[model samples]
Target chain A: MLPMFSGKLCQCLSVTRFPSILFLGVIYVAYVLVGGLIFWKLEGCSCITNKYSLLAITVLKMIKAASLSGLSPDSNDTADGFWKFTSSSVFAATVVTTIGYGNIIPLTTAGQIFCVLFALFGIPLNVVILNRVGKYMLAIERNFSLKMMWWVLTFLYFVVPMLLFKEYEGWSYAEAIYYCFITLSTIGFGDYVADHNPAINYPEWYSCLMAAWIFFGLAWLALLINHSIDLLESVNAYMRRRKNAQTQV
Target chain B: MLPMFSGKLCQCLSVTRFPSILFLGVIYVAYVLVGGLIFWKLEGCSCITNKYSLLAITVLKMIKAASLSGLSPDSNDTADGFWKFTSSSVFAATVVTTIGYGNIIPLTTAGQIFCVLFALFGIPLNVVILNRVGKYMLAIERNFSLKMMWWVLTFLYFVVPMLLFKEYEGWSYAEAIYYCFITLSTIGFGDYVADHNPAINYPEWYSCLMAAWIFFGLAWLALLINHSIDLLESVNAYMRRRKNAQTQV
Candidate 1:
């Protein structure tokens, strides 16, 4: 029975000549861990913020001093404008890419109007730019092997970013990968956003880095999608031809 | 000055023979308003909820009754499962469509894993379905007038939904339009979600209606995109040919 089982396993192994998928998967995981470590060093470490405790203490003092029921928190006072330079640029990038995390959406009427106008023109402009860049990428891709292209996409564009986000955003592995997948798929679920934690003071360049990553990553994704559509169309045409021949016969 | 201005306007109008863009713009506005009114009638009116005041009263009573220094509100108790049938269906639709509103996400590891796997297969399936349906839409479109196609797509799909969401969600006109545009564009910022107000009781069929709208609306948007891309490519080819001819000359 043992000999027969060993024989069956050997046959299964022989049937699949190369374990390319498994090998790629391992490399992808390793790339994320190592890239995360590198980014952790570069982005610097974070210290705990005492703001919450301070606010709690202040609030308690205020409550104790004013014993009357006339004290109500003004909700309007809590609403702060998030239209800083880095945030605005990130918002703009999200709009053009169709990610639209909407974590910091435009609130005022004029701002909303601007957002619509920007999207009206920006979406097409983004598509044009991506197509032009994709042409150049396609030219470059043709010179490289298919495995090499996959490695580049998997390692640098995808895996590395996953770990980098994990390190910077302090999310678990699953959450990090989830965020990356969601964003790249253009499913910008704004649930787990990078640099959203008020306690952690991220570097000035972080948002820029994230924006650049999204731009290049999306271009690569577009190339992959285009290739996929082409493959599907050719297959479809071949199947139609077969069907037509069968009918004629 | 008036005569010269009128003459200049006449020349501009002549240069652009058909005011198609302007004519379409008026129809689009009218469609949204009429659609909004129709949907408002169908979805029913809303009343204000007293839950907030009730909660405030309870909290105040609690504080007065108990020497609350030893008591703290459990944040965990406030967290309830949002994964009801209707919500789950909406969430699934969002994932497949790559809309990912992130208003309600998978909190468990098992759910998150399932989400990733679902998205992996679902996005491709969605693309394939859209392509097949788009082929039929193309056939129908070719048989009909272009203006007719625009009216159908604009009035039935885009304009109608804008109002429906406004009526149900109680958003302003601008907000409704913004939500529709954001969603159809697939940005899906999710700043304004339908049936999000806990105060108002939404009908069971509301979410199903929304899911259907998104699926069919996306198909129309996809067709529009394909047409635009085809036009752009042809224009690109013409420009390339002109450049080649100029170079040869």
Candidate 2:
């Protein structure tokens, strides 16, 4: 009797322990471990690039100070104007879109204040507009007679852009795909920004095209997220129903 | 008769043209222009830092290559491990949270692929959990007797953490507020990441505390977004109702 009681107790403990915060914490740690292992293997063991970059920035600052003090001619050739209309639009879009790539952040105090206010207003406007547009797209996608064609178009959307990025930016296919995912996810890491190379002198249409792609793609992404959640909920309900039937039996 | 017909035509053109894509496009362009003008005024008409940074990176690469080829002793003193358990978890959280800082991105092809897959699953999971938690918090907020106190607590939430960041990171109050808005908005420009200074020997809990703050703050942000949208929608509804009543009168 004591052995049976102990066995039941063990079963209860096993079931209860595996579904709560402790279990989630363990899984989270494991996920992080796996990520670390892979990143370490691939990227080589390293630390934050902040130290090296900080060193470089300090040197640059000293050089700037020297130039201002008439030690050397300012290298106008190496420095391009960052606030060109096209690039500024991209920057503004990044703020409104909440993509904040950090590649071209405002350095001055006033600019930073403006950035905050711009975001405060722009983020909601973008969200509301996108929400409206997304619903329209979803309705179209649902009602389209040729659903397969629509899916193919969606597939082509990503594939075609991958080629453009590969050709223009010299990124490999994997990197292009990675960029697409990262951007669409709104992660905007700014690590692999397109059209950032000044020497290439990309066409005016290039950045505009990429910006439009992201603008529309974000709405599509939100739609997909909603659909995915709906799918998961349905599957969950089905599983619950099956369990209920088993219990009844 | 001709003048009145022309006047009606002009009225029709004005009303129709100002309500569609053209109007929105004009507003968007104006917004971008204002942003550009402000940034230029504050930041001193400049181009991207890409050129200088590329030069710096190239030099760093040469240094690394020389070290690898045994021309110079490696400067291991300046480097630290990027894949510490805590940092790895922070990286994982960033991916799942869709706030990719790009400061410590995966350099390997395999690692990048893993990152993509991890995000695919992790984002949805995080969203689901946060959605559930947000609802609970909203319920609590609604039912609490001291709504004013709760609001004050929310105010203090941002204020207290701003102090902590100011002390530890040496950011001014304005810079700290900017970071808070940028991060909570999920713009995550990454230009101002906390705890990035390797020289500062931060407490073990520092990063973890910041991470927790972001995670919780994200849910609160969602709630705020929802509330703002609801408020806008109700105002819209009220405006429409008044318009309809006026027409009837």
DockQ, per model, reads 0.21, 0.20
Span of ten consecutive residues with least summed lDDT in model 1 chain A: A43-52
lDDT of 2 by residue, B1-249 (tens): 556545544543454333432433354334334433332332221222122343455555554453443333233321224443344455666776777666656555655666777667566655655564465566455444336746664675588778988999889988988888888888988877888776678888987788668877887877777777677556655765676688699
Q: Could you tell me how far off, in angstroms, the CA of residue A167 lies in candidate 2 after the best superposition? A: 1.6
Q: What is the C-alpha lDDT profile of model 1 across A69-132, one tens digit per residue?
A: 4555542222322333444555667776788776756555445555666666556656765665
Give candidate 2's whole-model lDDT: 0.61
Q: Per-prediction RMSD in angstroms?
A: 15.7, 21.6
Per-residue CA lDDT of model 1 for B1-249, tens digit only, reads 555545544543443422433443354334334433332332222111122222333454455444445445442232322434444555666776777766656655555666676666556656765665565566555555557887887787767877887777787778877777788778887766777777678888986687667767787777876666666557666765676688699
Best by TM-score: 2
lDDT of 2 by residue, A160-182 (tens): 88999999999999999888888
Model 2 chain A TM-score equals 0.65
How does model 2 score by TM-score?
A: 0.69
Please give the distance, in angstroms, between residue B101's alpha carbon in candidate 1 and its true position after superposition.
1.1
